[model samples]
Target: MEPQWVPSAADIAGARVTDFATFVTARTGESFPDYQSLWQWSVDNVAGFWGALWDYFELGERSGAVLVSTEMPGTKWFPAQQLNYVEQVVRQARTDRPAILGVDEDGSVIELSWAELLGGTAAFARALRELGVGRGDRVAGYLPNIPHAVIAFLATASIGAVWSACGQDYSAQAALDRLGQLEPKVLVTADGYRFGGKTHDKTADIAALRAGLPSLAVTVLVSRIGGTLPDVLAWDELLAAPGGQIDIAPVDFEHPLWVLYSSGTTGKPKGIVHGHGGVLLEHLKAVALQSDIGRDDTFFWYTSPSWMMWNFQVAGLLTGATIVTYDGSPSTPTPDALWAIAARTGATVVGTSPGYVLACAKAGVVPRRDHDLSALRMVGITGSSLPPSSSLWLRDNVGEHIPVASISGGTDVVSAFIGGVRTVPVWPGELSAPYLGVALDAWDEKGHPVRGAVGELVITKPMPSMPVRFWDDEDGSRYHDAYFDMYPGVWRHGDWITVNDHGSITVHGRSDSTLNRHGIRMGSADIYQVVEALPEVAEALVLGIELPEGRYWMPLFVVPAAGVELTDEVKARINTAIRAEVSPRHVPDEIITAPGIPHTRTGKKLEVPLKKLFQGAELSRVVAPTAVDDPALLTWYAQHTPPN
Candidate 1:
């Protein structure tokens, strides 16, 4: 830790604090409180907690009932309410103030004022209506981080249509895997994008995708890279369409707003359906409390259109802050591109995934030391755990006064569990506490709350932001099985973590059979499927094990096919195939050929025990899944493991 980076209180005095204890405290309010009390209040009274959040933000018109219960797992927030998500976001855009800032790879910047954004979005909404894109229709986008992407989403969401998006970098297969499930009516995308000194286009890919999805009516293209446009209508032509005034359509609070997918645990991805009012209200509250977004503030988050961070970042505008969108790799022209953009844009709050920060640290780029970050008041880190080294580096180099808030949560809830506060004390590498209104608890294997030990991270109650349903999941069986089935109605998030004595949390990666490799989240099954498919492999087991660098990396061990010999070429081929089939992150650093893979009594792979074995750590009796075969395989794996 840098000597100059003395631990200190959170940067929360000037911003809002929705709730603390029995009294609801506003930014201008006199008294202040700590994290523990606030967290207790949120967990104790879930309905009132969410209600306070809704009221604090002066949310959508309350046409229906408030809430029915705050009971764990089955809690229904705002039982009856009707509001439009896009209306809440766009409604606050006053004429002159900047609403959106877009910076491309070429260092060219485009700024859109609130008036411009609102008008353009309205026109887009009108064009959609002309195209017969109405309520319940699905409008999908495979685009980059640009103003038009935001506008398209806002417009689609405003009209009560479901908006889904994927980044341009996504492969044709990945795009089809996600978008095909939603079956969007219109496909909105750009011809190409520039990233990592490469010009990549989706023209051919989109053409192929369009052919597969019969429900797609129109193909909308926003030209960025210089190329011949396909049969898709140009963006300018649609924007040039007669600007007709369309009244913002409001809908039920629970009406479907957006549909997104998780990287599949099974073969096909799970399409998570999020609602209108709940997402808007919850996101607004999050931006206000977690990020401390203000009217005068300009917010920036480096995220691809595919990542859920895009949804989290775009929602920052609901707090009336200018959103800065960048459409290229952070290191495209230089390692300092993001900082330079933040400095130039006068961004107050800079948000990025932990991987980006670690990369910046590895590049020897000191942000505050190299760039004029005086305007940067807070730094929000997510997507992965903030390495203690990087956390200290940020605190020291960036300015000790600048709070480094490490937030955690996923698309399932469309909100955060642990995040920042305006006035609470900031701790190093600690997610201060659960966000207000979210009933989060760190429970041991026995399903009892425990402290200072890793356990299953579960949210006792359902929040407003919980996904409405999974697309095409008839009878709600998939939806129920995903969350409630684990604990019989409790929302069990598959995160292995521990809550510290100070109420802060440390995430231990996914509890489910998945690996968080270099911040690229992928299911273990993805690796196993490829590994087992090989002719040289009979069975394969993969696990994400912690490395000395304080991060998790994938390690693979496999049983050789019958009598197949272990050779360097076999290992090379397996690595090569994994990189091609999955993302680059799927390739394990070490691939060892073993005689057999360990399995439990029920024939399921003992991933946890094998993971522990690989790490040279011990655990109590493993949770034997009903699928293991060879118990002796574990002993063999431990002995033949590669030397460190």
Candidate 2:
């Protein structure tokens, strides 16, 4: 495929990656003519590349080895480095620019300066200390994507306490399933949050959530939308405490900075722990170099606290970029709400999901035409694969010059393996390149690398951002079995990918939810790309189920477009398109009209869980109700199971 957009000479010269290349050449006496060569050298000389980054970023002196071990799940990075995540962020603080921009659905905006941010963080840190929260203690937040959430997280990090959060959208039971694992000593929550022009009172839910977490010593509540809870400390009061000099507690390189949870589609969500030093280094590389964001840039990603993108967006602060937090629905009052937020905030780099882009496309919403998005340098998409049609739509509607960076990684690493490179050409529906130091490749079942064909996405080398450990997994058995069990020592990320000859990657979908038919394995994303592209289809879910006697049942569930009926003609067109675009053998056994498709809170399709539901598994056993976007959809899917 031809490149949709290529970097101009000026763009290349101005990018941070180019400067880093020059720095690398000066240090190693090696010249990298292009990104591919640079990436190869980075993976080959992991220690040298990481050490160079430490020096390049001026992340203080490194006393010990850059990399102590190379073993998967055991790799030790910056073994002797004692640093604080908040310290790195504070180093970038400037008085002239705001540190954060908080926006709401009502178009209200709040600007937090670096001095005020540090002061608030200091106050909250002192309060946390008073509450007996110390190093390694988990501080959980049941809050929305607001400035206070950022303040609370920074405060937790400043005190060397591990922070974990769930969006206020989750039910109390759902919050308990994830946050209860931490047994946090301090819980920061909001009485309510605004979304879709409505106030959702979470005070009752917060009370229930607090009741379940027996380890909680104190609950601090932010009174959003005029809701109130009894016996909880007010957010204002917490920040009103006597502010002193910000105290950034130095911790070990592997000290847990925060705990992120996996989508508990199968069982209890696993608390994925990441360290302070690793996150600091990786984010500086990701936000500054690959995405080309810097001091003057205002970065905004439409994400809730539950998603890793929120964590990634917080990393923008590490680069001295002002970050924007939106605490409202993406489509509330208008389909272009997020675009408007980006424009109003003057966000240079805006990130959203593919679903939102496609929804905008279907709604005929041209962001550039409707909103003043001239400040946008890049539009990032993640959470799932970006269909080719959606990518093209963004190029035509958003801006031809602004690259649509379709990044694919997961909460597992809290960072991307392959994503945007400012100096690279933007290919429709493909990530620009494997991120520097990420030894990413597509390998067959036999462990041989393959190109132009779908294979398992594996990381052959250690990344600084890979999880330091899993909470409560003392023996390391669970962590080992999660990634390394598939390919011993190699991180087997459970996604199908195709690395084309041009070095771009296309993530198909989850390998565990693959659609296999007649000895051919296909990704569910392939079907959605073709089926959902049709004007009549709003969303699609394809399932490939193994039946008795080697027989297979493949069903395609679709949510029809608004005011459109799923007649025989629509089904026929879908079948013909699948037959031509995909394969005849992979066509669904039947086309079923559904009310809606279920997704996780972070906007991932519930493919594996729904497949388990159709395969006669009990609803309670297959998936937790609160984990889904609409729990009723699970019962509806269970009722519509295919016949034997």
Candidate 3:
């Protein structure tokens, strides 16, 4: 498809990325004619580009030489530098500005100013100190997306203690699988949380988590609805404690700052560690330069702390943007609840997921008609690939001129590899461009770069935001095997992707989730795009099941929309659409009616996990039942037989 939205001259000139070009010209006495050229310069001249970003963001006092070795994993990056992630974020806080804003599922609101945030962190840091928590100690949060959670994270980072959090919605076992890996010294949590207008007390679940982690020394509780824990510090008490001030002590550049978990669809979640300096620099570029967020911008992203978007959402503060977080049912009192929050907050850049957009589309919820989204210019969507119709739905229903930027990255990097570029036109259902400083390309199984064809998404170069290390993989063998084992030295991010000549990208799905029909490779997303486009289909999951004697079957399981049965006509329509829209070879061998498609809590279809289940493997070995939204549905996959 030809690009539908192009930046006007004013739009191009006013962009931060354009300012970056001017900044480069002034600093290096070189002129970049366009955004892509500047991006190329950023890739080709990593030292100059990253070093300039460090100076531009004023990250910290530069002591060590930048880019000591240009190697992949062993890059001697700022070996002598010292910084703290919290100090870099909090230093930008203006006492007059609101630093954090939150809304509950019950429509309750919470706001914290920069001064209050500073004071709250100081007090919480004192409490952590009292608990004997110090630099390099682990701190964890099992809380909702509330102001207190943000304050607690800031406090943990303030004390140089590593911070990791799982939102209260996670199942107890899933919580154990992730937080158990860290063995945090201090665990901050809420008594309960509200979702879909109902309160779920987390007391028992919290006890289960406590029982699993033997290293936990202190438990702090924030009563959201209202509850008390014996012998536990209240969140208010921690904030109102008598103690005093906190000056963030600078840690080494490579010191482990925080741990983020990889989606453990296959096995135990790998604790991917990132350092203070690397995250600071990467976030500044991503938030300020990539998304065009600034002091005047209100950045809102709907995410649980379990997802990396929560980390990115809070990092918006590093760019002086007020970070607005929502923790509750996106559609409760009304289907337009999230848009109402965006309107109330005057959000400039609204971050969301594709599933949410599709839900709104299916429900006929129109933001432009029901809400005052005058301040909204950008709607950023991630989590999964967006179909072309849904991309157009934003234009037709939300705002004709608004750019709905599709972003793709994961917990692996904790930052986007492919996303929108304000300087370029955004093609519908396509990413605007590759993220600057990321050498992203599509590659075939033979390790050759391929464009305009779906192939393995590979990172040709190392990124600063790449994990500092996996938590327990001491010899780095697991890390190497996870990314580099397939293609030696290069980072094969296990997603199927295609890059067009215009630099726009279409991410199909996970490479592991790709369906192999005979010898042809197909993305499950391709089947979904064709099947879900039919009015009778609500959602779909497709996987090629390999059987004994090299037998194979591709089954398409779909959740039919209300009043729409999986009749013969619908089946024929699906087959015809697949054969027409995709290809004759891309049609599934079987069509089955599924009551509901199973997904991870984060809105990803459980294709790969289900494939393993149908292949006669034990359910537990395939995926953590707690990680899935519907464990019962997963078991049903193994029980149901496809048509002969």
Candidate 4:
């Protein structure tokens, strides 16, 4: 299974950005011989880097100071420029070209041209303004991946309002827990979402959430699941409402553009606030440079509004590329549904997480044999560290020559640390390089940057797109503790990572996800050492579960050898073998056979999502399978819970 097209040596040779001359001269009246000087300058002068970016994009400005704080923990960028983030994106392209393309689960496809998207967004913006939305007002959505989601995001950002969204698959309480923190003025949602031949209605939950939040002024519902919304306003009605041609409101560059949540480790999620100009400028660089998006490209990333990928996808608008949006599971109708869409729409870039690729492989989707993926030139992957085995499998089985980029970055930056580069060679299981203007370093605990060895991943300086503030943290105490407090001005991204000689990055899992059993700190990957190597196991999850007996006990959740039964002897062998390889604490107190491990919609083992489930909480709907499935495993675990 290989890609139909590969860049010839000539093509590769012509794609290099040898110097940062044009961008530098235009933004700063200076030019650099190479990217090294630019990168070093960014590290030495953080504020200058951000200020240059603002001018480079020619961002709209307001009548105040451009930036107020250059100090870490409260640093701000483009403080004086006032402009609506959405307005900048909307006007970036010609009105006749496509801006968004949505294909639903029922095989219905709809396209919105630049004019239509702008006009529709204007109408919705007018609707929000009329509904009393003003600067800094929070607008939230619990929706699926549809045109309306994009419409709502643009509309909210256009009006100088803060947009925050989560997936519709979230339980009523999970949605409430995150959205309530913002005290949003409006909520946009769909009636339901269809997945794996099932429909999950969100209307009732929306009503419940609205009732709980006194600040909610309106509820906008898109007709989904073939149901009518009597009380909620229809998406079309909001888009069609006559308003005297709503004008784009310009505001401060550092003004709040969006409010997103940190998937909480403790009680409630932390609301991270992103700025307008900084986010827009940085994303523009990412879309045009890293993604290699252009006016002729049709781009699609299988994502919901809940994840940061949605933010990344919408940035395609800034590049004048058509964003192909899909609202159902990739595996719906058939495992090849996404490929079919790419083939039909001629999507040049197909972005997804590594977990989805693995699932597709396990499901027997030989992409090269099953369908025509000639149009897809690149595949962007993130959400979890991609192992070398999976990366090679994709090249050998899915598509060769089509670079599989394993990107790593998150909500805080609104971009990637290391991602796809048009000129860089794609290596298996590694990120090609740190994004330009993002000074990245792999540092040991001693604060010295290191390479060819594992350490903490950190940015030695601030970037324009770092979150402006945290909601409810008036004094910025919590915000400080999250990033800066850990290392004084330097951002401590808590991932144990290694940098190769070629400057590629390899994620060794999360610093927090490391298991501590009997004073031994082991990454969850440590368990896979013996488990995956065995002939009888397809996959396994090894973690410490707190028992009612007041002790943390390790549990091995195993997907047994294919076509083999999970007998007591087989389970004993698994336990005995792991303890022998690593330590006894690494062995499981109970061997639970599961059909599949629960995972986030993005494909990361919802260690937290599953922790919620194990604690008797509702499960969020997952669009991709993250683990090997075994139906009887959870039941067996329940039967063996250490009695209180």
Candidate 5:
């Protein structure tokens, strides 16, 4: 848990975080002895700290008060702010620089310059207007991770229309479940998408989505795979609407900018809405300063349109950084595809899931020796409890000089709460520091602050990017119950965390799925660390089912590597590994080898849903097909699983 990689003098000198420290020192005339001290000061003076961040990014003009409310769910900031999220993001865009670079699974790349982006957004916005999509209207996208999704979002936000997007890979019902709630007036889709060297046409899925949403007045199709829909406007036609240029709409401070869905594991996904002023300020700090993305950087994070990282990638443009996206399996064709993208694009900050990094390690991928990745200055990681070994492996196999950021946060806030800080050294298996102005803490079950022990991750103070309101949840009943129910006057984020004495935090999976063995609790990450470390296992999932009469059935499902058989020896190795690395109390009652583990489209283990399914919860109530990678895998689980 110590610092795995130390920042060089040049690295520290050039970091935007260091620059912010100097800026804060000059403004407040307070000496932040270190990054830790600066973070403490930021949380302590939340209002002044955020105001300085807004000033640092120069996100937008401020005429009124900076601090308004600090209460949970109702905390308001930037009282008189009048601006647009798209405007702040694309303000520095110019014709000279390439604004977006996208790569698909079929080895195709799409690059758009600033002028093309601006002109396309303008045309698209005009097209939306021509279709009667006006201010406060909803425009949803059942799209892939591509430049078109970005353009559609920019265009929708440009005209003050709220934007929401579902991944193209989502099943028809899942897509309907999410987009149906928003009742978008306009829907955007592509003919299909390619992943893992396979093509999937989403034409039928798109039709199904349109059928379920009665409010849709227009459906625009991007012939990404080269096909025309019967009654839809082509992507090219939308761009040829004869509009002059992008017209940024300056709405009120609290105007709804976009809607993101909660990862509805046990029930229908909640449509979490965020505003322009708040996200603008929060994303500015999270991206520009904490992540050190700027004009000189080409940033890439392998993410789908459904995940919050997609929104974060788009936020990269707020600092004039070139946004690069890859719409394919991270390990397509070979285990080196992600690293190949980094090398080919000359990406300055290469962000991906720890799953990908761990895959490279398991597959013996040494991109530093095999590929030219000299331009990769930082490896930004997230989407799970990043094992310390993965961080060290990335440094050894990719680039030793590169800093590896093991970060955490969630879709609840579109920005990271604990993640990158350029001023701090890359600590193994830990986040750098609390994101500036995020009042984060570790709380016991009774809501007591605790250190060096696992506790619930709670946010004591309101954040600018916290969900303004859940769509259709009038009277704020559901909103309060979603976050504040567990901890009075605080946001219980539902994840178990440990803030150590070393000024870093480690996320111990979701608290709901915490494993209990004879009154001893074990984080799933602990079992995962032991099982996946074995060469035979590729991925693993653990769940403890409690029954009456003090009985428990703990199952460990593992997806073995190709060509590996599920022999007794393999099971013995797994059980022994868990007993050795963790404790005997953590060993599973059974080790089942499965073909694959079901992951959310965003690549999180479907642990809670599967647990519910085992406990006799209805499939529809337990799992949303739209939220998962393969519904077929779940059917297999349901059929093969024994009754409790």
Candidate 6:
């Protein structure tokens, strides 16, 4: 593939990765002639690279060894350091710049200065303390992507309490399924949220969620859309309280910072816990070095509280860059809503999903021509594979000079393993390089490394940001089984990837059965739980298929009851149940009547095989007839044409 864009001489000279290379050379007397060599050195000498980062970033006194072990699930990094993520963020606060810029769907803007953000965090931290939220306690947020969510998260982290959140778009049952596992002490919520030019009242959902969580001692309401709830504390009152200087509680390197949920493919979502020091160091390396964001940049990513990108966007504050949060649909009144916000906020780096970019291309919305994008320097795409045409369209429409960086990572680490580097050329439909300190490789089924062909994505070495533990997994059984069951000691991320000889990577869609729709990951079990509840539905199967040109097709197959027929009314009822119970995004594109749903002999749904069949793969290549419960149903599913 030819290069779509290349960095200028000034970009290479001014990049933080280049500066870090020079620093490494000065410290260890090792010369790295290029980005690939630097990455190679970083992976080969993991301890030295991490130790140098600790000193280069001036992260407080490092006492213990940088790496304790090399085992995958048991590997430990910085075993003796005590640090806080909020404290690192506080060090970058400046009086001259705004710490946060919040925008709503109606074009209202809210700016929080560094002093105000610090005050809000202090006051909320005091309130949490008064409510008996101590170290290791969980604080859950049922809120939107507003500044209050950030303030509440900071306050929770400031007190050494673990934070977890679900966006308002999630239903009461869905939210409870994830947050109920935490047994949190406090719940922060809002009355309503706006999306797609409509106001969604979450008051009833909040009441149900609060009722289900018997462990909640306090409920704080933000009053975003204005409603009253009995026995709830007001957000305004919490921030209005007189607060002194912020108190950042020092925590050990392995202390849990926050809990993020997986898609719950098998059952209930898994609570993945990341530590304080690990997140601090990893985000500093990711945000500062790979993305080339710094003090003068305004980082904006269209994200909600449910996605990992929200956390990644908040890490911009750790790098002294301004962060912007949007609390509505990316495309409401126009296709260029995000672009307009970028223009208004003077965003230097803008992150979005491939679906949004393809929509812009389809709508004939030229961002650089319609908006004042003079400040824009880069466009980032993630959450799914970026088609080559979409990447080229971004280069043509957004700006020829702006690099289109397509990053691939997941909620497991909360950071990218392969992403962009400002010094490297941008190739369409491919990521520039594997991140420094990440021993990433493509391996065949037999564990041999492969190049220029699709294979399982594996990480050979341990990253600082790998989860400390699963929330309730005391024996570490679930944690070990999740990543190590397939490759033994290697971390096998459930994605197929092709690593070229040039060290660039092209990510195919997921190899697992997890459903990814519009960049938000949902479990097929979630849909089945809702759809199969109807009396007319006997059995159900759902598939989220990724097609060419950045299109997604999700279809629900249902087996009707003995006396019932599959009709439009039943389909409407199924769709309504899924939307009201699970999530609107998981609503299937089509509902079809099936003679029976195929499953394995062990009773697990054959989701991955059926998904590949609909994606145009042959049945012989995707599945074996002897392994299925019914071979006839597989043929039935393969005969149906996929949606355009």
TM-score (all chains, Cα) for each model: 0.90, 0.83, 0.82, 0.77, 0.82, 0.99
Candidate 1 on 1-644: residue-level lDDT in tens? Answer: 12222234333334466332324655324333665666676667666667766776677455445566654434455656767777666557676568999998888889898777777788898888889989999999989889999989989988889899887766566677788887788999888888877777667877777887889989988988866655777888888755445467878778888887776754577889888767877787688766778687889988877777788889878878899999888776787678888898999898876667777787888778788998998888886777677788787767777878778888787678888776555666667667877778887766888888888888887777788778898787888888777677677888878887766788766666656654445666666667788999998877777554456656688778987876898999889877655545678878877777666675667776667655556433443323447555555665754345
- Badly placed stretches (over 4 Å) of model 6 are none
Q: Give the whole-model CA lDDT for all candidates, comma-separated.
A: 0.75, 0.86, 0.81, 0.71, 0.81, 0.92
Best by lDDT: 6
Write candidate 2's Cα lDDT for 1-644 as tens digits: 89998999999888899999999999889998889999999999999999999999998887989988888879998887899989888899799899999998999999999998889999999999988999989999999999999999999999899999988766676678789998999899998888888878887888889999999888998888788778788889888866767888999988999999876533567889999988888888988998989998999998888878899999999989999999888888898888889889999999987667867887999898999998898998887677777788888998999998878887888888999898899888888899999999999999999999989999999998899999889999999998999799999988889998889998866666756443233456656767899999999888876543224578999999999999999999999987655445447999999999999999889888877666666889978989989988887888885676
Better lDDT candidate (3, 4): 3
Off by over 4 Å in 1: 1-12, 18-32, 71-75, 242-246, 518-520, 524-542, 556-608, 623-627, 640-644
> For model 4, what is the C-alpha lDDT against the true structure?
0.71
Question: What lDDT tens digits, residue by residue, belong to model 4 across residues 214-322?
Answer: 8987888888877665567788777775534447787777888888777554336778788887788788778876677778889998876767788889899887889
Local error of candidate 5 at residue 398 (angstroms): 0.7
Task: Report the alpha-carbon TM-score of model 2 versus the true structure.
Answer: 0.83
The better candidate by lDDT, 4 or 6, is 6
Q: List where candidate 5 sits over 4 angstroms from the true fold.
A: 241-243, 513-644
State the lDDT at 84 in candidate 5.
Answer: 89
Candidate with the larger TM-score of 1 and 3: 1
lDDT (10s digit) by residue, model 5, range 515-622: 644323345765675688899999988887653322457898989998999899889988887764444557888988787899999888988888767766688888
Looking at candidate 3, the ten consecutive residues that score lowest on lDDT are 514-523
Worst 10-residue lDDT window for candidate 5 reads 514-523
Clashes of each: 9, 0, 0, 14, 0, 0
Q: Once model 4 is optimally superposed onto the true structure by TM-score, how far is the C-alpha of residue 315 displaced, in angstroms?
A: 0.8
Which segments of candidate 4 are over 4 A away from where they belong?
1-22, 25-38, 44-48, 60-70, 242-245, 514-644
lDDT of 5 at 295: 88
lDDT of 3: 0.81
Q: Write the per-residue lDDT of candidate 3 for residues 1-644, one digit (tens) a residue.
A: 77767888988999998988888889988878888888888888877888889888776568768868666565667888888888877668696669888777766667878778778888888888889999999999998888887878888887788999987766566677788998899899999887777787888888888999899998999987687677688888777754345667778887777788875534566789988878888888898888999898899988778778888889888888888878777777787788988988888899876657877887999999988999999999887777777788888888978888888887778889999878888888889998889888899999999987978999887778888889998998888888888888899988878988888898765556655442233346555656788889999888876554234678888899999989999999999987645445567888889888888999788887787677666888888989989878876787886444
Evaluated at residue 402, the lDDT of candidate 4 is 81
